[model samples]
Target: MAPLALLVAAFLAYSVPPYLTFDPALSRVPAPPGFAAHYGFLVAHILFGTIAIVGVILQIWPWLRRTHPVVHRRVGRVYVFAGAIPSALMALVIAPFSSFGPAAAGLNVVAALLWLGSTIAGWRAIRQRRYADHRKWMVRSFAMAMNTLLSRVYAPLAFLGLGPSYPKLGELIPAASTLAGTMSMLTLLLLSQWWLDRKPKKPAIAR
Candidate 1:
């Protein structure tokens, strides 16, 4: 239920119109100085990131994995080979230009690294028949991929929550954006790992 809601919202928000309209604040990227490479990476990142998010969402659904094994593998391939890897690589290229600041940029770099690492590790674990490890690593990877949803949240929350004080604090808005955005990313990363690591209770024997 949660994944469905989140994936849908992500596609609606960050996936398309925002990129086409290209609002600096809403898109969370400052305008590049007419550079082609920047535009290339930005578009690639958004397009593939959307694919990764949707792929991860479907891949995590237990029913799909159980009922459609072939589809699950296909989606998993799309998530990794065609989506996450390229998106993460392009993310590393464009992260430094984050309008939020250096802190936000650094957090993005970390997110990209973990996103790629955990995804690849998950793939290798599956190949080695370590299903548990595969699930664990994929959970972590999806959480990193969720930076798309989490990072977009902080700016609005801070700006709107601080609206009454906006006049006086206008100059500090950029710093506030960075602080809120970076903290959001870290909080999501930690929470996701914790959620994934919680042990399921053993079924009562002979009940």
Candidate 2:
């Protein structure tokens, strides 16, 4: 299930139409600035972000990590150096285009800030040989990366649960989507951190 979910996530990240690339339904609202910056940053964000996601997902697999340490290290380099860093940085730029609303856009700014910090921290942890801390931060980073996926999931469910289509509450889609996305981010944070806590302590830092 984990692998399948990871695959789907990677697929979405790669194949999902560039929401900000055009003034379509998903990205209809123009928040101050227009589409050029939005499109550029979004392109950078999704491409590298998806690569990082796929790398991290494979890194999390115990079998691959255990049996093929070499592969893990190589992908880790790509994840941190090539994918995560650039993706998070680009997210910072495009976050303002969150069609949901200003609140959503603002929260996205916060998330991008945190995501960049965590990915960098995770990279530093590995360098310092604190494998445990590295893993913990990577989990956090991955969870935040699921922001897009979860929000999409929640919005449709919210629409259905409320009534049916846009006719029920069309204008409020932003609010509903924002609410759902925020909940998803928080839930993922708590659950991932809790999972870390359940693991047996191993000298805090590896050394």
Candidate 3:
């Protein structure tokens, strides 16, 4: 997970600078004409989502959780209120106008809703002192939040896998990207469940 997180951080370092620059010329996907607020929403979503990812790393660290439970709880609040909720809300606002196509838009919408919903569920569970449920739901929330990184990871792989066989690569890229997002969500969901069900190995007895 550390290596994967470092890789994602590297990807963000490379990919996020243009958006931060606030120059439309550097925008990866320009705001559709007539929707002036789209760029603002996109930037907000990116920033908050980045925060949520960082929070996840710290929240899940065994040393932090074990040694500093109070800090963990405080960070959890920030992750919920300052990061995931805002990012997911902004995602809802922007997803319908996706440049890729309606399919991509729909996928984004679903992912955002699930991300928002799972995070909320986790928060509620913790509030009610249902620690087990909280962990499960938070795992799901993390998986949903990670869709951003996973989708980006999948896009290039999809291109490489499909480029040679498909004659009209340009036309297919949008659909392929949507498929990649779908696959990312599904893959992450499965992994999250596996995590939830995993049991710690018992220590071997000394003979």
Number of clashes recorded per candidate: 0, 0, 0
The C-alpha stretches of model 3 lying farther than 4 A from their native spots are none
Candidate 3 global lDDT: 0.89
Q: Write the per-residue lDDT of candidate 1 for residues 1-207, one digit (tens) a residue.
A: 585666567555645776766544555455566554776688788888878887888898888999999999999999999889999999998887766557767877888988999999999999999998998899889888877676666767767766666565644576567656676778877888788878777779933
Q: Candidate 1 or 2, higher TM-score? A: 1
- Per-residue lDDT tens digits for candidate 2, residues 65-168, read 88999999999899887788898888888777677678888878877887788888998999999988998898888777776667666776665654543464
- Point out where model 1 deviates above 4 Å: 10-15, 18-28, 160-170, 203-207
Worst 10 residues of 1 by lDDT: 22-31
Steric clash pairs (candidate 2) = none
Candidate 3 TM-score over all chains jointly: 0.93
Alpha carbon lDDT at 40, candidate 2: 55
Can you give the TM-score per candidate against the true fold? 0.82, 0.80, 0.93
Worst 10 residues of 2 by lDDT: 20-29
